[model samples]
Every structure is written in C-alpha cells, then in structure tokens.
Target chain A: MVLAFKNETFRDDFTFSNSPAAIRRFPFPFVEDKYMYSVNIEPHELGPKGSVYEFPIDIDEHYVSEMRDRALVLDADPGRCQALPHMITAQWDMLELLMTSMARDYPEHFSLTRDGNQWHWINRPLGIDHKFTFGDVATLPYQPMEYIGRQCQGDFSIQDQRDGQLWMDAGIITTQADWSLDFDVGMNFFEWHAPVPLAHQAGVFDRALKFLLNMQHGRPVRRLNWTMTINSRLDTSPENYHKWGIDRTTVTPENVGDKVHLRVELQALWRLPRSNAILFSIRCYMIKMRELATVPKWGRRLPRVLRTLPDEIADYKGLTRYRQTTIDWLSKYDDGAPTSLGGGPD
Target chain B: MSTIKSRPIYPGLSPDPNARRNVVVCDAAGAEAVVELLARADGEFAGRTSVVLSSEGLFGKESESIVERLKPATVETTAGLVPAIDRLKEILASATMGLRLYAAGSEPLIGSVVQAGAENFIDPLSVRTEHRGSLKRRVQCVHCKGMTENVTTNPVKCAQCGLLLLVRDHYSKRLAAFQGVCINAETPDESPELKVEFQ
Candidate 1:
C-alpha cells in the first residue's frame, strides 16, 4: 500500500454511500462528544433546522467484535488499523464533503473562528495541490528560511463555516493561495477560513511581517512596525495556520442601527515528513463573535435550536484524546463579498 | 474641517447642548470601520462633505501600512496623487492579522464640524450670510450663539444681553488639528501572492 496517494476519496459526490453493508465504511458528519456544548440560540431567517448530533465513526463495530473473537487478548487484527493511506484519504474526502454540506445545509449559522470565539461559515471550491513547511522549528530562530522561493504540490481545502474542515497533502516549504480561518486544527482539518480583502499579499511569508495596519485612531494610517511570527508546526502548535488575513467591516451612519461584523480566515502549509517525526498538517479555528454572536438568554427555547438528538455512547477505551476547539467566517452571503473594511456604526 | 453630529434617541441628563466635537476610543476594529461609517454618513447625509479618515498616536503606523496596502493612491502627492478631499490623520498604522476578534463593540469618536447628526456641518455660505448681516453678526459666539458687541474684547456684561458675551478664537481652536495622510486613495491589494517552494 502506498503511504501518500493524492486522491482523498473515491467520489466527488457530497451525499449517499455506495452500499449499506450490515457494516458501513463512511459515516455521516459529526462533532466529538468531548467538544459538544449546549447553546441557546435564536435562528435567523435562513438558519438550519438540524438537531445536535455527534461526529460519526468511520469504522464498524462488527469488525472490532470479529477481531475480539480471534481471542488471545483480541486476535491478530488491528482494531482501528486499516490501510494507513485508506484512512488518510477517507478522512480528507469526507471532510471536504462535510464542509460543503454544512455550508449548504446551514448558511446563516455558517462561521469562522476569530479572536477566540466561534461562528458560522459556508464553503468555497479549492485548488488542486501545494505543500509548505512548518514555520517554527525547535532549532531554527533568527534565520530566514532557505525555501522562500520554492514550490510543492498538494490539494488545498479551506472551510471557515461553523463546521468547516480542511485537508491537504503537503511538503515542507511551499506557499498557498487560498486563505481561511476560525476553526480547530487536528489530523482532520488543518486550515480554517481566510479573512476577506487581506487574503492576497505581496511579500514572502515573513515570520513576523506586518499585517492589517491603522488599528488606532486619529492618525495618518502609516505602514511600519508590522512584524509578527506565524507558527506552522503541528506537533508544537498544531491548532492553526501561520499566515492569515483580516478585515474590520462596519455599518455606516447612513445605514443607521446596524450591527458590526468582522470577517476573518487563517491559513497554513504542511509537508508529510520522511523521518520518525510525523509530518502534521494540523490546526483549527475558534472565534468570540461574542458581540457579533450572542450566547444570549432568549425569552423561550424554540423546538429546534443548534441541538443534536442524544445517542448511546460507544466505548471510549484506548481513544487518543484531543483537547482543543476552533472557529472562522465567510466573506459574503446576505451582502456582496465584504466590499471593504469601512468604519463606524450607522 | 470635519463635523460632529450626535443622534441620541434616549433622553439624558447631559443631553443639554451635547453637540460638541469630540473623539472616541475605538479598539482596533472599531477605529477602522466606525470611522468609515461616520465619514460616509457625515459626508452624504449630514452635508459634512468630504470629512476625511484622520488619525494620530500609535494607530498611524499601521494605518499607513494598510493605507499603502489598500489605498496606495493616498500615499502619493503629485497632482493625480493629491486627494480632492481631506481625511482624518493618525500617527501609527499596521495591518490586521486576519484574526482580530478583540475589537467588536468599541465605538470611537467621530469629530465632525457639527453635531453627530446635524442638518449641516459648515454653512460655507454663512460667511457671506454674515457678511450681509454685517461684522456684528459675523463674530457670533458658536457656543453661546450671541453676537459679540465689541468684536475684539470679551464682554464681561452686555447692555443688550444679561450674560457675558463669548467669542470664538479661530486661531487657537484650529491649531494642532489632526490632519490626514491618505491624501490619495493608495492601498491596492491587486495580489499578495507569496511564492512557496517544496524542500
């Protein structure tokens, strides 16, 4: 079996499975039990009607039972092990489908993770292939990377919606065009959504380059002192991408009585490693949307909120635990792509 | 000269003559978006035409960076580069890191020439109107809204009015005014594509 074959999944289709065996292979999209939380929400006009549901397991229990039947402390069959490539490919494929479905199914609730909070988001079609290096090497400091003017090959996926996902086959030292942010980064989804307007930049990925200027008031917006550090090592800070873009949009006084929303996205690059150290394309997004998104106490609970029907727990034994959350947003939907980061509340 | 317009729907104790020009402390996102909204409305609806995006302090450096990235035209000064209108000025400016969730609800100040929601900012024709009304009416107090009888001296007590007559010191009031650096629209994000090579 090949270690890294390019195509993530067999089909381009978002819905339906090939066949339903007493045991199935691909499962429906879901969140982990450890991460799920109860939220009180009032849906917008275009909100979804879905109840809460946990993420599904792609493996079948019958197979696990079969291995156990072999005895001797559970047979020669590797319980969760499959062809390594098959698992990787399946995960990537399913993630893409899930991202698109989430956008299509729930547009209003679509978001990206920003400023340490969560929100809703939709989907965007992506580029074929590219690869990149981890910015923060334990041994490297105060030194510009030698791979600045280089190229690699891999598919790119950026999903900033509430349930966005990203998967890429990458190499060390390459750059990406698509930007995204607002979600957690794990083995499954590496990059989040890219912020609007700032998606495209003009320089090399400076470890600490200046981004988004003029954050203060009453001065000529100047362009110096924009040094910053972008972290890309999955093992170290696998929660996100190194490079990103942001836009601070607003409601003008002319519009009068409107809320402000900031659209943002995070980006990263990855290369599968050849050493004992595993190559990780890792990260996720989380946003506050605190002001924009209210964890408000509503007058009454609607029958259908952001809830999933409760299900019986499968065994949690031997499961490697992940302990983090992420979020990010779309550029446009109700309005045109965020035209510009204009100022003031109308 | 910009304008100030206040539209407070709720009644208040300090609502008495609240139409004074002032500044607001907007967090990162607040300064950028809020200023744009305020400027646009002041220019379009309130006739505070051409109010600019001015800045000062640490905001200028980054603002300048963004000004260069988004509206590069604002940076040049050769004829075509010259702004037809003026905007607010700042000291420092930079770019947003694509994840500025920290600035959501902070409202900065919008210093207009008039109230936040005034019918007019500066009656450009007012000078002429006052010219027709004579020197006595030209030197009226902006705050007290009364004519300065002596035009030059502060009236301790006036025969025509009971209260002390106030006069505007145009020279002192207009000095140290924050000016705009985006004399022209310059930042153009045509593309910021970074080249990546595989190792």
Candidate 2:
C-alpha cells in the first residue's frame, strides 16, 4: 500500500520514504488551520462517478430493554461472570466504522437511526452449573454491534464470528504473524463520537472530496478517521474501550493519508449484486497547538482549538490551480455533481 | 474514571482513597445506573444524564491505559469554549480526578468508537538533536563498577567496581536519546532537574 504523489513541495505530501505508501503531509494547511476544515479532496475529472446508496438501520427497543435487565443481574452477582452491556457498546463502536463510511458516502440517500443497541448471546453457557443459562443472562431481540449496521463489498470478517470480531488490522492476516486484526491508526486520531452540528459536516465532506481528487491525480491519499469532543456532551467517550483494555493505540497526524486508486477496477471489487465500495480522499496535517488529552468528571474530550488547524486563512483569494488536466472516467452510478472544485487557475 | 465519589456497593467504600481507584462503566442501564444511584448523596452523577460518559463506568474491564478510577472528565479543547467556560468552572470547582470517554460509532458503521486514541505513548521533545550531539561519550564501567575514562569501545569494563557495563543497543548510536544515565548518582547533593548534562 505505498502511496505515490507528484507534489513534494507542500508539507502535506509524502515525506517518509520508508513507509510503503507515499504520504501527504499537508494540503491546503491554511484552510484547515483557519476555518477548522480537516481533510480536503480536489475535483476528479477522470475519476469514476461514485455510486450513492444508503442502507436502513433500525434497532428494536424491546430487545434493548430485556438484555439490559439481564446485564444488571450479572453485574449484581459479580461471581456469576457475564459480558456486561457496556462491552456491547464497545463492540457497537467497531461496527460503526463501516456503517458511517457508507452513510457519509450517501448523506442525501441513507439515514440510519437504530435505537436500543443491545446484544444477548443466547444458546451459550453462562456459569459452570449453568445456573445463569442463556435466557437468564441474555434475551432475544437484542441487536448486536455487528447487527448495528453495515455496508461492505468484499468478504469481511462479519461472515464468520468464530474468528472473533470480523475486523482486520493493517498487517496481513497470515500465519506466523497470523490474524493481525491490528490496524495502525494515526496518532492524533482519537476515539470519540457525538452528534456534531450539520454546519461542520459540509466543510468536512468537502475535504473528503478534495482528498479523493488528489488520489485521482496520482497523488496518494492516506489516512481517514474522525474523533469528537465530548466534554460538552458527556465523559463516557469512545476511547474508554474497557472490553479491550485499550485507552489509545500508537498513531500520528502523519498516517491517516490513504492512496486511493481511481483506475483500479472498482466494479469488480464490489462483490455483491448491487454492493459498492465508497471512494474518498483525505489530507491530514500537523496541528500547531497540540492540546493535551484530558479526562473530566463526566466526559472525555480532545481540545477544541479550531483556530490552530491548517494554514493561513486569508490567502486563498490569490492562489490559483497549479495545472489543468482532464480526468479519466471509470464508472459512475449517480448523477449528482461529481467535482468539488475551487476558484483556482483552471 | 468518575470523580463523583460513591459508597461501596451493598456495604461501605474503601477505607483508603488510593485503594478505591477502580470503577466500571455501563450504558444508560446496568452498572453505570448503579453509580448514578449510589452518588445521590454526593450529588455527583445524580441529575446529570452524562452518567455514561466515563469510560471506566461503562460495562468494561479496568486497566492502566484508562484514567484513574473516580476521576473527573472534561473536554481537552478550548475552542468556541466561552459558552462552556461557566460549565467548565462548575465541574472544576468540585474536588477530585477525571478521565475522558471513548465512544466510537457512525450512522451505518456499528463499531465506531469515536473516543479511542491512536497514541500508545508520546514523549515530547524539549531538547534539540544538534544540542545533544555536542556532549561527550560518557559510559559506565563494566569491570570496576566506576565512571572511568579511556574506554572507547562497547561493553566497557569499570576500573573502580570491576563491573562490566554494556551499552544498550550499541548499533543505534543516538546522541539525543541518552539511556541508563544515573544523573542522580552523578550529583546526590544537587536537584536532579538542574543537573542537565552528564559532563
């Protein structure tokens, strides 16, 4: 997965040669620094017109209530070990990744609103004497995280729960170094989630478009993920993955960059009859004001200094596009505007 | 971890504060509900709906990477924070520690733990690489157990204590990252913070 880029001048482009992928240090750092914009994608004239579709996500309320009751009994009787409801919430977070990527791709199409996300593993033994049998500790109608929601094109781990969580880390799933479900996320990317205002979504999505365009231009797009500030919301942030005993893993602002291949056969990659993988690009940069990660009484959130994001804000008026090249068309399923462009030299 | 103190379930709390450093987290229901129920006296998580924001309070396994149990939680950012200033002041006014929450999930994505961090550990750079290169190659003696001169090779023997001391990862040969330097042993009388250089 080595990313190759043409521009080596900006801080956003690839700086590390040792890494298999050519990286992008900073693209439009000024925009991110000024307006609080994150990743940026340029318009792709040659890139395929991506398909847009949304899947439904509706969870049952009864299922949540029943399982929650059982979870209480287990925690009440500590000796009678049971997987707590909170562990299910952690699992819920993992399942959200694929779901969100899908939803974001079709914001105008799909809206997943699932309520009562709980899981009760029935048909499984709870205690040695089986005093707390499947139904006693868990209930039906409980929606597991895997059942939370999903949108995939290939044979993901979800096909087999016996192999554990249907997820893979960055490394290969091979023998010797077998089943490395360990994905190396960037350093600055935090584990968090909350309802952010729609005001910021547009700018963020715009960045994604720009990042994808860079990939179409042979500029490798690297890294894609998001974290939300919860101090304003609540202390129970996503990073508190109690199930895995992980507060944080090793990641840096430098690695989120992804090298998207536009010319690659995308249709063939879609394994399902109507399934498709979303195409997106992102540009991550080093923040000047590195706020320390802190824990509060009720919420755990990262710093909210939006001012120190990318580069100089006021200089966009004069800058122009460096070059003008027609894009190579692959395949498009939607009829919406494909290019997210700027007023730079065309 | 939650800063809102709670009495031990069914009985009383830990006699020592240090021993009371473990907490568990649940969802809107279960273990977390108990914390809110128990903290009625302290008025900690009682009225607040954020009872589930504490990572440790979730139905989870406890360990070090998480914040201290019973610690307070707060947003680390200060942007557009004027409105939160009054609220932040109120939380800080209360006594105790806090920790951040990790909630990751998205619209269609089921396992999005948004609060997770990518950093396993981070060491800030307070010194320049060039500045550290000017210092001499100081080594511990492997033979005599003494800080002696004239030894230029790896795994040098001490002249005084006769103890053999091997340089860790001799091939890495980095100047800025000086390892195994007992700055305290060099100057027991001076403050360790002030004793910057081995020279």
Candidate 3:
C-alpha cells in the first residue's frame, strides 16, 4: 500500500512527527528494562505485515522528507556522500540490491524493469522515471551509488571485505547519529568503532566481524542501534554538530515532551553478489517523547533504560546534558512495570 | 581508555635485516630513537640505509649532534617535517621490493610518513614508528575541515574556523590527523579551561 508521505522539515522549524500507525511500527530498541552492549544480531528476514522488517528496504511516511533533507545536506557538503575509486563495482551491486528489493516490496510506489543491461526505474513518490544502462556510470545522472542512495530512505555504506576485515570504503551518510563518513571512509570495522566505550572490551567487534566475514550472498543480518536527539533533526552529524548541539540546552521539564526525541537505527547488512562487498543500510526513525509515551511499554522501559544507563555510554551518546530531564518527563508514563520479552508495542 | 585503537601506536624502531633497502624518516627529537635503533643494527644496515632528518624543532642541536655519530651511506637533512615527508614520498615512488620504511619523532611526522606510504601501496601498519619529542597533535577541525598543526591544548582553537575544538583521540589515518570537534557548541559562551594534555 502507498504511504501518505509527510511534508515535514527535519530542520529550521522542525515540523517532523510520527502518526499513530507510524508510532506502532517504531523499532523501540530496548527489549528489557536495563541495556548494555551486545552483539544483538538477527537474520534480516520478513516480519509481520505492519512491522518495519516487513520489507528488506523499508519506505515509510518520512521517506520523502528524509530524502529531501539528505539532498540539502549533500548540497551544503558534498563530502557526506563519498565512494573511493575502487568501489565502482560495489556501487552497481548496491544499486541492483536496493532497486530490486524496493520494487518488489512496494510495487505501488516503485517499479524496476530490467531488459538485460538496460534498466528502467520509476520512483512514484519522488516523481522520477529514468532509463539507463545498468553498469555504465556515464548513463546515470550521478554515480551508481549516489543515484540510488539519494532515492533510498536510509544512510547507505558499502564495506569492501579483504584481509579478513570490512573496510568502510563508500557511503552516503547524511543522517548519521554523530559519526562522520568523511573521517571514517577508509577505516576498518574495528578502527571505525574505536570511539565506542565498553564494546571493544566486551569483544563485541571481534565476534561481529567474524560473523560478517562469514556472511553469505543470499543471507542478510540486522541489528538495532539507538541514540537520542534534541529535536526531530535528521542531520545530527558531527559535521554540523556546532549548529545543532545548542539544542541540548533548550530542553527543560516543560518542553521535554515536545523537544526530546528517541532516534533508533534499523541497521541491516547484506553481502553483495557481484563485488563480495557488504551493503550496510542504517534507517533512522525518530519519535518525540510525547509520541512514544502513547505506547505504555515504551514509555516505561525507555526511562529505566536511561536511568540505569552506564555513565560512560551516557556520555558517549551525548545524553549527559538532558538525560535527567528526558527521564523525568518519560517517568510520568512509567508505573515501574516490567517490560515484555521483545521490543514490540504492548 | 585514553588510547584509542584507531590511533597509531609506536612499537619502537627495529632494524629489518632481511630488507634490501632501508628508509628512515624522522624529525629532530626522533634522532635519539634512530640512534637507539641503529645501535642494535649490524654494520651492513648502515650501508643499505638512507636517512631523512628534519632538524627544525626544539631538539635541532641535539639531533645534529646525534646525526654526526651516524655512519649510514647517505644522510639527507631538510628544514622541517613537511620537506622531510616530501623527500620520503620521492624515495617511496622510486622504491623497489624488499624496502623497509621506519618513521620516528612527533606523531605528525610518523603519521605523515605512514600516510604517504599508504598512498604508495605500502601498508601503514608495516611502517615502524617511535614517538619522541613534543606530544602536540595535528588536528583536523570537523567543522571547516581545516588542518591545524601542532595543537598542544585539549580545547584548542581551530586554526581556520576559530571554533574551540575538543581534540578527540579518535583519529583518521587517511587524513593523518586527530578529529577536533567544537567543544562549546552546546553552550557557546562558557569556555572550558584549556589543558596542555598533548604536550
């Protein structure tokens, strides 16, 4: 079914909000009351009809607006989307994966017709219908990855697997939580995640890297990562942190419900068929504190997750300034009840 | 916790006897490390070695005195680290098989050599590094993307954008510098006291 794409802004006035349907499918990351680092991964298989995992490439109400914000970010800093010279083959692999998945899942909104090397793609929401030679970069308006990545909802990265490591060779990362793809473009999996506390000591990367290295062509894996943002701002990137960081101070007891947002990332990884590379898609979903409290389980669990959150992690996530305010606001919805087994709305 | 994994570590220089050629790049303070490294080397090492020294910083006189004692086949002295790196790049371009690369002195010097080696198809981790002299850093401002060299303070002011940046240990080998983010972005007026942590 076609989604009612929202005409919202992620910046300036910050008009972004989630509908009731959208909030129900929100990927609430905390499964239990307390949270800690883990290699929490699962197969990227189809889930129940209305869940975010219903499709390989999820397109929601925010798709149009998110894509627009991505364009604005790229316009301001072209460095946000980058691919090394060697990632050309992987770029085509990414285009094929996204196009086929999106078209198959949401046939109403997207269509892809392939006639050998010549391919025709129509994105109804964005109002684009283009025909191009599949493997040729000259036939497309932009590079293969950028052309398709701009159309997709999430931040996409392609990792070149070599020397028993995944290299962050290419990505379009406009909506990253705090990391900079420009700074981390060529870093290996371990190197790029160096800043994260406790996880390294926990051998999380070692196990995760081993798992990813052995990932096969048809199989894809998924995980959930989260961070908090002051507003419903999509570009919480370090590149523009100076502009948005001050929003942390704006949060108070009164405005916490409207101001604070829980940003969750549905990170999915696929092993590309052609390039032997991995396609890492990070789909960001943001819901305000007030909207999230509508779901009783989420409202209760989020506060517990925040209150008992490790000091190191809390600092690392940049929640030191406004965590107490957000927790105190969210606490009103919590009756100190135990959450259910999984991260689903009760 | 202060040591980040991405930040390159100096394992101290050791002579590679199996190498057909040896290229040693260093700054003024690194001359002692070179001397210490050469003390353990065999006589044949001196014959095959080419040394690039930059006597520009505070330890210049000490570096010269130490350089005088070296008996390598060739010694090339430059005005500073930038020129020394340029000379290293020239050598790397013409480098043949069985070449061993070693870098010493300030982190910037070592990082530049490693970066240049990486651009020339040499693995950065393969380059031997030894830290010496000033602990000052070379920071890249995340805002303006400017490279501020010789940053000594924790909340150092960006050389280009003038933003007070928190010098994070999170480093980038490709850029050969540490990441500097705006420290006072949340509360612009309240400035934190600058600490000379790096030096």
Candidate 4:
C-alpha cells in the first residue's frame, strides 16, 4: 500500500510493481469480450463475508496517499475544487455527512462532537482537531466540501434538485474520468450525459434520473463505470489528454498487455438530508491486462469482448487504434482454453 | 478394472519461491487441499511460522488434527472473508520480505484476501491461490449494490435490498460478483421469468 517514492512528491518517477495482492483484488469488469452501460446500482450492505463497500465512507490503505495526492492536485489547480453560490448549504451538509460517516466507520482516526450548532472535529490521520460553527464560513479555512474533501479519498460532486431535475452545481473533482465539471456545472442531468449514446433513445437516462429524484434522503445508491487507460496515472481528464493520450498511441503490441489498464470508477449517489442535493462520489481503480490475465476466465473473456465491441462504442472508449494489437496480445493467454463463448480457442 | 471417481480441481496459480513465512487462507470447499498445500509449503518453507484462516463453520474437522500438529496460529471468520482479511492486514503489516501467502477457497474469498494482501504491499509473485468450492454465483443487486451469495435461482431475491434480481451472465471482477438486474424492470409489477442460463 505505502510505496517508497523516489522523493516525497507525486512525481512521474513513482513506479508501480504488480503484487499478488493487487491481482487478486483487481475487479475484472469484462464478463464477455464486449461491455455495455447499465444502471448496475446495488444497495450497500455487509456480506457474511466482509465487503469493501460495507461502510459509506471506506478508509482503506490508499487513504493517506490518495488524500495527499488530492492536496497536491488542488494546490496546483484550485479550480479543480469548487462550490457554486447555490450549493453553499449543500457543501456544509456534505461536510457533516462525511465527518459523521468517517467518525462512525473509523473510530480510531476520526471523531465528531456537536453542542447545538457548534461542532468539534478531530481527524487523527491528518493531525487536526478543530472547532467550528456549522454554517459560518469564517470558521473554516477553505470551502466546507473542499476542507472535508481534502480529508477523504474520493472526488465529490453535489447536484441540487430543482425545477423537476438535478443540476450539476457543486463539486471538488481533482481526479475526473474524462469529463470536466467546468463545462458540466449548471447543466441538467440529461445535458451532462448528452454524450453517452443510447441512454437517451432507450429512455434509460430519463428513468434513471427519475429514480434518483425519488431516492430517499437517507438512502444511497452506488454503481460501477469502467474504461481503459494507457498507464497508471490518475489525471486523465481531456485537459491532460496530450500527456496521457500519446501513451495510448505509442503502446506496442508486445507491451500492450502491461501498458493498458482497466480503470473502474465506483460511483455512489446519496441524497443530502437538508439541501435536497445529491452527493456523488467517485473512486477510481486501475489494473493492467497482464495482471487481469492471472484470473483465467478474465484472461479469456477480454479478447473476445474487444473483437465484438461495436465500432461506435469502441471509438467512444478510445479503443479504436490499439484494439486489434491488444486483442492479439491477450490471445497468448487462450492456450486453446474454453471461453464463455463456447468454442475452441480462436 | 474399477475406476476411481475423478472430479477436476479448479486450476489455481502456484507460488514458485514458496518463501519462509506462510499465511494460508481457505474456505470450506478449499479445505480438501489444505493438507497438500501445507505439506508443499512445509517442504519448501522449512521452520517457518504460519497463520491459517478458515471461513466460518467450513474449516474441515479432519484437517483440525494436522492443523493442530502444525501448531499454526488459526482464525475462523463468521462474517465472510472480509473479517478474516482484516485480521490478515495486521499480520501482513509486520510481515517480512520472505513471507508468502497461500489462498484456497471460493473466488470471492481468494479475491478478497488477495486484495487485502495487495493493500499491504505484498507482491503477486509470492502469493498462490487454489480456488475450491461451488461455481454458484455471487450476485450484486443493481438497485441496492448489495451482494447475495450462493444464488442458484435465475430470479433470486437480493439479501440486502429485497429486489427480485435476474442474475446476468456478465460478471464484474471488481466486486468479484455478477450483475443482477430487476426481473420486473420494464414492467415493474409483472415479474417475468429470465428463461436464460448463466454462461
């Protein structure tokens, strides 16, 4: 979990080695050679076996490192962390929710005490114990969400429900999965997902929006979204595409397995109690094709999925150029093995 | 000549070095291989200390004698592999470079334990897994994100959210579970049979 970095900075020199631990835990998304978008939401619960999503605010080994990385990203670009004028109250709501969740889930590190409107927060991990009035901006150094966001691992956004739809109003997103909040702010739910194909035609987005609108304040829904990235870098927004996009093109057939990574975003949506705004959080995870191959069935399924992926979807995922090469590389794992497709190895 | 009943074992990955310190994790189904796994480890990793974790209720009673003979530190988990993994996290934190992890269980158990080891910075090269148990699917409800275990019915009820889920053939490696959509998705009230098999 904690790697010895070359320096005490989030620099390019940071190299990652594939560990057995990572391979076993890697969420292999491809059930078949092709993937599709669906409202794959599930309720959060503790299984007979422990699950990662058992708690609302999950504090894992990546907690400290991710928080540090967020700080570094925010320090470089304050724009990455923003709260709209209308979302001020929602920000405070989010701050309280996160604090309470963390305090409950991780008692050793976080604690929250309230005396009416005045609140006391102690974050042992970050070494901060402070007292602040609930609604007073001057009581905190930064915006309410950003202050708490700095302590949490995932990037967050708060969408206000008004005029019969949800608005993309407020968030602290330093690590985005391709989309930018700068352009998305103030846009309605459908407008925000305007680029996602078939959802509109099939009425999936409308149905989903309505379901979110009706979601109870206390209850939350979570879903998973996936994409492929060229490297392990977290900053892959369009603004930085020139930096990472080039790597996608440069990946050779022999190295594609090691270079390409499956980036999965575990997104959760919660309806805030007071403001009626939805708190959306995204946590990104990456695992390479070679590492994925360690899981026998997963190794067999991906190549077929790539071969059958629709052109439009493949282009949307930016898998146009390297799809064939990646498939060829994955073919090495088949070894005449049976796939879910039920045929002799291709 | 009489024939011996032969059931194929799940082809699990093996650790080459097998190291001096071992942590063996297993569930009920994987209990069959515990003796062989331990013997192999003992041969390669002589004089090493071990901590073995077994899923609740399923740890083999017959294996208990061999386990007692090895004098290995043991933990039995009732709340799935997550609790066992939480314990493993502490042991791995202080673990030395030569420590090797062996997992023998269902896919979810192995996956969860592997994730825990990975979180502790264990190299994949030092970890071996022998998948045992049923192919019965673990399905996650799309409505609630809660997972229902050992589901055989196509339209299975989600244990967490109480939704009638149609377990899709598509599996999610991240959750180490399959996607289960509402059976009555289009026609909210009129439930329809999935009439499809899990691939």
**Model 3 lDDT on a 0 to 1 scale:** 0.92
Question: Ten residues in a row with the worst lDDT in model 4 chain A?
Answer: A1-10
Predicted model with the maximum lDDT: 3
The residue-by-residue lDDT of candidate 1 on A172-244, one tens digit each, is 2112222211111211221121121122232221111121111111111111010011111111111111111
Order the candidate numbers by lDDT, best to worst: 3, 4, 2, 1
| Per-residue lDDT of candidate 2, residues B26-128 (tens digit) | 2222223233333532434322222222222223334222223323421122121122232333333451443221221110000111111112111111100
What DockQ does predicted model 2 obtain?
A: 0.02
Cα error, residue A307 of model 2, in Å, equals: 16
Kindly list the per-residue Cα lDDT of model 1 for residues B39-86, writing each as its tens digit: 433332222112123233335577555344323112221111012112
Error of 1 at B164 (Å): 54
Model 1 alpha-carbon miss at residue A10, Å:
11
Docking class of 4: incorrect
Worst 10 residues of 3 chain A by lDDT: A336-345
Residue B153 in model 4: lDDT: 70
Question: What are the TM-scores, per candidate, against the unseen true structure?
Answer: 0.17, 0.18, 0.98, 0.58
Error of 4 at A205 (Å): 1.0
| Candidate 2 vs 3: which has more DockQ | 3
The top-ranked prediction according to DockQ is 3
RMSD score of candidate 3 (Å) = 1.4
